[model samples]
Target: MDNIRHRHITSFQSGYDPVLEPIVFDEKRKTKKPFRISSIKLKNTLAPALATIRNFYNKYYNIIHPLSFTFLSFLTRFYLISLSDVVMWDESHFGKFASHYLNRVFYFDVHPPLGKMMVALAGLLAGYDGSFNFESGTRYPEDLNYTFMRMFMASFGVLMVPLAYFTSIELGFSKHAVILVTLMVLFDTAYLCISRFILLDAMLLFFTFMTIFCMTKFHNQKCDPFSANWWRWLIMTGISIGCVSSVKWIGLFTTALVGLYTIEDLWNKLGDLSIPKIDYLKHWVARIICLIVLPILIYIGCFAIHFAILTHSGPGDSQMSSLFQAGLIGNDFAENPLELAYGSRITLKNTGFGGGLLHSHVEEYPGGSGQQQVTCYHHEDINNDWIVLKPREIEIYDNETDVDVEFVNNGDTIRLLHLGTERNLHSHEVPAPLTRAHWEVSCYGNDTNGDEKDYWVIEAVDDIYKKTNRIRSLSTSIRFRHKVLGCYLRAANIGLPDWGFRQVEVTCDKRNNPKDIFTHWNIERHWNSRLPPGGKANYKSKFLRDFWNLNVAMYNANNALVADPDGFDILTSKPRQWPILEVGLRMCNWASDLIKFYLLGNPAVWWSGTVSLIMFILTLFCYLVRRQRQYNDFSPVQWTYFLYVGRICLIGWLLHYLPFYIMGRVTYLHHYFPALYFSILMAGFLMDHFTASCSLKTKNIIFSIHYALIITIFWYFKDTAYGVYSPNIELRGKKWLNTWDIVD
Candidate 1:
């Protein structure tokens, strides 16, 4: 078309409907000298060939789609997968998570529980009995049925092709576009490699694509808004939301996409003259129930299942309250519950958003107000215990204060007496163990009782509205606000060296962010309880309270997780570089005998996707301009093409890709998979649009070139993508980029 050299290209190429373009290949173009196929025999032959393609579409389309889908699924299971045997990359993390599910060992992960749960389900179904530890670079156990697990994940990966294909058809894309979408996923080397690994990416992507697929199907039923199939697809979209969201919080990106579309759909419906007000109301309520309420219930159900299965305490226990821990079987808190009163000696434990306990060691600071180092200890020790001491004046007047068995009530201003060093928990002008902006809480001067700086007012958040409420057993979350310095006590979650026992650093900060768990402390072990003899733990009330505490902990932990200067991430990629396929992330390898799995995008898909994106923008701009100049002047296929390819897919891609740039977290190339999916679909749009006007011979040539290139590239990269190779082979003969290292 470009070589034909028209005098001027219109807002859109005229007379090119993707649906009929292949059928009417004999139609003459308005080029400088119209492109001609003067051969009578060739023209005669083309009719039968085109007629055969039309007949296949009209008669055997249904059979072909399913058959093609089956073949792709089988190919995915047979090849791209089942190539690796030993543990690779996140398999170590997720495989252990699966084992924990089998053993009922509760653990923590940044992602939601469903993906890991699915992984566990896959392993269980495959006859794995939670035996393998799945340590990094370690070989999987002999009896482990890894193939079934891999095949299970491969099934989800292959399911994406059909979803995209069917969704494309529903969106009114050309037959070629639908087929191209399937082929795009089939030949994507990175998709093949990542899906094969025992990770959540495969499931995450599957649910995400299904969510989009259902969304397209739902919207495609706009004319039949009251139809059974419409409602079915709508509800299925909501369920898909729950499925995808429960895999990773990043699924929020797709959720947001759906939300915006829902709003737009409703707004458009409301403006429709045919839609009565009552009908619009009915639609609104339906979407609210399906999209909002149903997804919420499903999301909560997944979490409830997560909590139910993980009954025993494991590595994640420290991140939860001791009261919450009491609910778990075979944990210390359940077996040994402690209560407390005034003058009761207790040790405060921080749930590890940032880890450690309220601790003080004998080691002094390097310089300035040198004393026993006050910190948060990660481990248990006798030195961590502190006495609930009254004010300096009350210590001498025992009769006045009754500093004996009287419970330390909420809002009570008390000084902590470090049992090991006998120094008041002081917060003065001295620099803290870490985060120098905060004041130090050091056991200064080695005094039995200290000055005003040492006195801390126990302001129990939400629990301290009254003075009568006492610090009871396994309850009462309070914050120590320094009276003199006027700053809240915090577990900085930063570790200090020898001076602070290399535990989490503790300090008093001027900032009192209510969302932060670092400033909140639960009286883990109070010596006096109101509960009668043989009283059991009230887990229902404790869980409700711990749920709020968990959110706070999650907030702090997620905050701490991002932008950690001490924790350098070599694999992390900037958000901007993702679309261009600039780099690769090395998954794992052992020095002795390496078989590295790098997280890299297929350059062919990534680069072509980028071009398609640019084309989408250019076409959109032209479409908008044309609409403005002559309203209702849209081409036949133009608006329909833009509906799925330009607007929805682009928005989905942007939603997944753009927000990561604002995040301070260490992100990698693998994070781009969701956006990469949209990009592949966008490429489909370009293929359909550009080829719509091409001659039969040119179309054949283009398709053949792409097919050959994809095959050649996939074949060339076979070893790196699938084979677990040794040092002897030359797998880097065509290292496309210097960064693309086939390390095995």
Candidate 2:
């Protein structure tokens, strides 16, 4: 059968010719038989029949050419369906920027504008209102509008399916290999979820794939490496790489890998056994020009375009200068002495005090009889060995009463519950019975009681009306105690019974009152809380410190009682053009900007990481064990797999783990997607090897099982096992074991 197939294929070497032969097949044997024909009959009947059959087969299957496989793979994978019910968290932020861009607002996003720009284009086409604000807007009733944005992102994500397909095809992947890779990407929940959002990961992956595709094309072509036309492809490669970088800096790794691959290709082409000194010098210069100079020029050219558009200035205008200027003039008040003296700086110390300058000295009078003048301080004592600066609080209680309260430490779960009851309660219809209450609470560290805790208190109060007596009380209060310090109160009150009324006026004692100390109360709804006052409610007659100053009259024995509990008082602090809170917010926005690389997900744990690590080690062992295998005898796909896997290990170690350990930054995940891509590629090569050198069906079953497992693992854990949102939630409860819980 094999011999007959070979002969049949060989007969068409000069192009398909059906004349002068009659093709025959043995029905019983299920194989092609020897062909025999008269010349006249072959020309008239056999020739046309064979040609018609060939044309029909090619047209029906659409497999007449190799590129048809890529087209078909793309078509099948481009279903562009929405993934989950809720938009993933990060998509909301990008959707806002895209909406702003469509409204012609200047949006200085931490990420490049391309992804959001694309989303905005989709929104515009879908007739979305330009005034819509994602942060404040309701998602319902406008579900289709939001879906439009997601659909746009998902479509771009599906593009990766074809991108990988064509990329594999260009690299000489088998038809099965191409289909498998495309399906792998399609079925990956992580990939699909990310694609269905207005995030830059899909865009970054798309451009990186394009860069790889262009490089593969260049490598396959025979040309003068130094020729202008030949170098055009190299320039295109560099530009594509730059586009990836523009989306996310992590794309630089892909660029570097491609650059190294190009240099290796050039070195192979040289084939120099031993060259004279002068010829070696000449070759060296040309290599440097092709590898270094040209790539740099192309990279800079691409960056120049981005710079001009983003900065409103030309290149060489000082990249560091703009960042510094933005830090100084754009947002940081500490940089300006005048602003520091009179401006407001929000600190962890002054959470409750108004967040504006001139808060501390606003109430100063000639004598001590005036409203106690609020004072500000630059530094405060860090209590309990924790780095948080202690804030001051003042309380005037008519009397103390037993109360039950709930506390939360790291925003994970409950820690402790204190139980109590009220006296002289009559009816059995009381809102809360005079029994010990069981409350769920969470605690962080200790204060003076050796159980330093942060929590919200819950209580039920009874009321009497003229016509009828009813039992009702406000549910919770924010509470804390440390050393000689104690603070507890309803953070914000909802409507509750007070004697004969449905509302009550809650006020705090007057402290060192400063001039320009503006007070206003804000009632906000908790989106995720489960109790009453958990949803929408209102606050009445609650004093709000609009601003607080920490520098006016540093916390001392005399003014300590008047200080705000949360430390730095933004209300008493003088107003500044730029404040510290804004700076921190900007930094957060900047750091969070790294989600574009898709690699910014969580580090693989004991299972996924360990399995990949073992596979990598085994691949290394095999390569070392089979060192006798010549380069040519090994398929380029196999060789590439080895190179790719080694690259993955090297890059993953440097990019994902090292920064986290050394710099205290976990930005490495931004570039980790390449590791996954290369791992799958290695698996493909391994399957190919087993099929070619061993049993085909056995290898197929094994690979199919392995692929199924990979998919299952990713699917099961994709929600909580990876990405910025995942590990954070899982580790939220394990705060004792994680020092990195400060992210919230």
Q: Largest lDDT belongs to which candidate?
A: 1
TM-score of 1: 0.84
Q: Could you give candidate 1's per-residue lDDT for residues 417-504 as a string of tens digits?
A: 8888787788888777568898877886544535788888886654322234666544556788888888988985676765555577
Error of 2 at 177 (Å): 3.0
Per-residue alpha-carbon lDDT of candidate 2 for residues 533-590, written as tens digits (9 for 90 to 100): 3111211111111001111211111122333334653222111111111110101121
Which regions of candidate 2 deviate over 4 angstroms?
1-87, 124-129, 140-144, 222-232, 262-613, 625-663, 666-671, 695-744
Q: Candidate 2: deviation at residue 375, Å?
A: 16
Report how far off residue 580 is in candidate 1 (Å).
1.9
- Measured by TM-score, the strongest candidate is 1
**Following a full C-alpha superposition, what root-mean-square deviation does model 2 have from the true structure?**
21.8
